[model samples]
Target: MAQLQLGPPPQQQQRPAQPGQPGQPQQLSPQAPRPPQQARPARPATPSDTPPSGQPDASRDQRRRALPGETVAPAPDETVIAPPRQRITNPTAVFSGLDKITGRIIAFDVAIDETVQFGALQVTPRVCYTRPPTETPQTTTFVEVDEVTLNGEVRRIYSGWMFAASPGLSGVEHAVYDVWLTDCKQSAPVIPGQAQSQPPATR
Candidate 1:
């Protein structure tokens, strides 16, 4: 049986913080002022454009020299000056054969180092390249097929790079001889006694 109506509890009508006024000290709602930050347009400086993450990329000191599956290469100032090596000037290379027990299809011009036999198969020609009649006619002969054997034994069979645009792609697959690669010649079939050279007087 007790009733306490304390006198100071009635004086709490002091509430003027009413913007949203919950407990009274929260009147901070006036913020629509933030549209002033537009300045970021400046990237136009390329002599190559790489260096800057702590700054060190002069192309990592001109990175190049990592071939076999290459992570990256060719850039020592980006040096790719390889347009010079095209000199075969007619080193002669014409080959064609198939004399499988005399079914006879023989044709030979061989003369880069010159061997040329073609019955029991001799045919030399070490490198007789030819591409540049404005490119892509590609003749490539490297040849070297020995085979003398009846027990006379010479046997070297065939050796690489013969492709006058893929005559079976790399020749001399012999049962009786198949040979291939036909073209790339600067003259080598005039030998009755060899004396034919007269044509240079027209200015």
Candidate 2:
């Protein structure tokens, strides 16, 4: 046995571990000193010029407003309105009768509530009306027609309104005589002995 020397062991050290030191390494403990910490870089501030999130920009608000002294008219209503129709009354209704077999056409006038004879038919006008001259001309008449058959039977043939503007639409289809309204007037020149109103026949 050799004599032991030194107050501290070479394999163990109480100091903190140092770099580039030779021999046995030193163990770190709570008493060891720490290195100084570096300061963190400052955070950049946000731009004040830009608008905040979730908001409309200034340019959009300008478009919503009208220009200076400019008139902004209100929106127009969607409903549409129409004018009332006006019609004028007349005293006489002028008509044209066509005889299919003879191909003869006769023009005549009958006063309201009076009947005129044409061939075997009696024509009576109830109403005669017309539109204003400034407006579209439309002459109309409500008339009744009776056909006297060979058996002395006065059968009702046609009873409806007749339009002067469209004669084809108002006529007796199968009868030999067809009468259509031509015009409505206040008075018509008298045709001497041409048309005579018949008295009511006794049953």
Candidate 3:
């Protein structure tokens, strides 16, 4: 018989199976699990982002500083000055007299010539007299006229007449008598028929 040597009974060799497949359980390792990631903190504000506590508001300070060389525009709340109110007095004819009358108020009728068309007529009456000065007359003279209210009512005075001129009177209208006088001086009596014509250039 030939020498037959059996090293050992034929050992059955088993092959390791692949993991994560049907009927195969996955093998576990000894490594530790990783931790969750944390979010970064927000950056703090710098000096440029926040103004100092002692400083004024930025917008207001800018406006005030801009006013030195530049004109600061007026605000809507600013007050505006209004023009003085003008009252119409002496509407018709201006009268004058020679005597010194004081506190004498009278109403007079003026007869404007209707034949000749007076172009843009203007009349001025002044009481001329010399009086002793109580105080030294200042170089700058200021004249004020005292007004007399009629029956506690205000009447519109024109250039000369105490009341407004008659609406009917016109350049072609003749013999229209609507003139009146008021607030005459009591001490001076007006010289009647002593009226003098004034040149148109005097206006």
lDDT of 1 by residue, 1-203 (tens): 89897654545656345665666575554586557899999987675776677866656544543556756755555666758656465777887788788788867677787787777778887878886776557777777889887877888878988777778877466787778877887776655457877999998
lDDT of 1 at 26: 53
Runs in model 3 deviating more than 4 A are 1-74, 79-81, 88-92, 95-189, 193-203
Best TM-score among the predictions, by candidate number = 2
lDDT of 3 by residue, 116-164 (tens): 1111222233322122244322111011122224355422233322212
What is the C-alpha RMSD, rounded to one decimal, of candidate 2?
19.1
lDDT of 2 by residue, 1-203 (tens): 99787666666556556855897476565687676798998765343445568876454555468698876554232244657778999888998988999999999989999999899889999999998878888999999998988999988888999999899887566458888889988976477887889999999
What's the C-alpha lDDT at position 179 in model 3?
24
Q: Residue 68 of candidate 3: its Cα lDDT? A: 56
- In model 1, state the lDDT of residue 126: 82
**Model 1, residue 149: what's the lDDT?**
78
How accurate locally, in lDDT, is each candidate? 0.74, 0.81, 0.34
Regarding TM-score, does 1 or 2 come out ahead?
A: 2
Clashes of 2: 0
